[model samples]
Target: MKRSTTLISVTLIFASIFSAGSRGGDALGKDSAGSENPMRRFLIEDGDPNLSAIIKHIDNMYRSKSSTSRLKLIVTKPRNTRTLTMKTWTKGEEKVLVIIEAPPREKGTATLKIEKNLWNYLPRIDRTIRIPPSMMLASWMGSDFTNDDLVHEASFHKDYESSLVGPSEDPNGWLIELKAKPDIVGLWKKLEVIVSEDGRIPLVSRYYDRKGRLARTLYYSDVKDFDGHIIPSKLVLIPEDKKGHKTELIYEDIDFDVPVPDRTFSLSNLERKK
Candidate 1:
């Protein structure tokens, strides 16, 4: 189904929250000098040394068993701007449900993703539509991000080869480049990520398309301690080609590893009136 770019923004923004959490996570824990670090011990490769461990840590920074959150999404263009308020629930690696609560015209609209399948629910028409794989690259809510940008299951540690880039602007911090393996097929030919020296928080990430052109830039800011998990509370996405266009997602509240009933992800819940 074709949707307004603004509406598409809402879906993709929530996807980012579930998948990237704006790249937030617990700080790297240290053990005794001779003890092995969980983040480094298991994933460390003999050839890459600390690079692999660092990438793995950054990739799984927001890893959790389950979560629920409320957030605001703003889509801006040269001529207009729109805002959407939404709540989302997630369990494990799959099962995500997102519902729109504000912008009355679109209230009660929802999206559900279980495993590899995705569906959209339109409250106004009371119809539930399944999103085909072909539409994965289509624009979501007219935002800078596409459908796949939110739900795509590519892994940084597995699908891409990572290497450190020296001479970074942040002293003591690191700039890492991730190039998709030749055999892996997906958007983003490469990624350049700038991580803070302390806590290893991801400050900014630049995504490059297949033609080696800059596709978009994702900026993480407004670091906040949510309960105990320290993570950026805001994410701004800007497409390289879209002038005067950007999408902003501000997390208002979140509960990690909380009890989200399985029924919360069912079709009945997706179609429920809010």
Candidate 2:
């Protein structure tokens, strides 16, 4: 019943994809001012097309201004179980670093940095490896998520060609599903996003595989207003094939626009830690 390292890695990679901020619906119809379509105005005024808003929505969740909760990752399967605690810090588009700590027998710590390049440091090996392109699809740390899932985070306005996918509903309000561009790289071929009509916060997303089959579903729950932005504090990921297998991520704390040390995301920093 033991899983291969590759399988474990894949699991972790996919898990991170679900757990991380990387992961999007649509509707049609008219405007209150009668000058243009109401829905279109809503989309523009809400800054849906603004890259800053989209990036801020995802990255600002881990800002350094205020103390935020540490991130805890629990990976479970029929045979293997692992838990990881991570502290993350970001500096503009130039740097991002995540320090990982795992307890018990593996007391080792590792640092991952994404700058102009990507690299990882292993305390045990005491070496830093520049991630190769071929390894992008490889599972991360014996989990289902791929390494690429972490490094190649997508932007809505740049990475996707979004359009209305019709109407949907959730606890947040009415929604519009958006489909990914056909040529976009990644596992998901399409996404169904539920945006709160009133709040303009994303509530839920349904991910479809390349085969056009429903592959996974992600729910963004527990909406909290932070710095004039409505953010989701809790996320749940459910697989289509695995009935009982589910992953949940709860943000312990979040901050925005705080100063992070410049060297915190350096590759040398990762190497020095090892």
Candidate 3:
């Protein structure tokens, strides 16, 4: 396929729906009376009492303040499959630039994300197009992961109300369930995440729809040291009903707390090589 055709076809898959948000992370605050929170009534605080700690670790696992990574993303759908090799530089959740580096056809194609605004650069046309709100939920780069995941529109800590699923559902690992706040928007109605108690490594996350039906599951595996921090190097997302469809993101290399130039997030740099 021609380079332009490939880009067009891949982008079209994500046109169904989306929005992008920038920052995340929220700490527990005092209730209205500055005392006990009413939500805590339904949560576990007896045995583990580590609900807050788990939430904090999960929220901060992937990135520090700034990071750079070489990622290999693979997507498979029915009769088609595609692999993309991209280099991503991120300054927190708000500022990010992902540039396709391999498969020559998409060499200069890049996406710049700053806050809620997103822009896509098409090197073939030498143009930068601002992504509209309607496209925020679209599959990003033709992967099952949406643009929302890319930009972090909803914070896992703030947007969702979390509670420990209790010891009955928890054995060797911690099981935390999160329900989206009324104001937040996304396809998932609730999410159940399992992480190791000691290593804080994510094991599995099940996404449920509004009706409480399983939508998809994200599996994390292959723990390795990315410099000083240990984290899962591979994440695979599998749909509940889609038999042959799944997306995998593998971190070839990652450097947390890496120095990112102040100007690296600018629009003009979208088409510029690092």
Best by TM-score: 1
lDDT per residue for candidate 1 within 40-105, as digits (tens), equals 444334423366667766665555667889989887889998888988887766677888898899
How far out, in Å, is residue 217 in model 1?
0.6
For model 2, residues 148-218, the per-residue Cα lDDT tens digits are 44445554555565555434554544444445676778777777666555424567777777788987777
Candidate 3 has its poorest 10 consecutive residues by lDDT at 13-22
True lDDT of residue 270, candidate 1: 77
Each candidate: what lDDT? 0.70, 0.49, 0.63
Ranking of candidates on lDDT, top first: 1, 3, 2
- Which parts of model 1 are misplaced by more than 4 Å? 1-49, 139-141, 170-172
RMSD of each predicted structure: 4.9, 7.7, 7.5
* Model 3 ranges off by over 4 Å: 1-49, 138-143, 167-172, 197-199
For each candidate, what TM-score against the reference?
0.83, 0.67, 0.77
On the 0 to 100 scale, the lDDT of residue 39 in model 3 is 26
Worst 10-residue lDDT window for candidate 1 reads: 26-35
Predicted candidate 1, C-alpha RMSD: 4.9
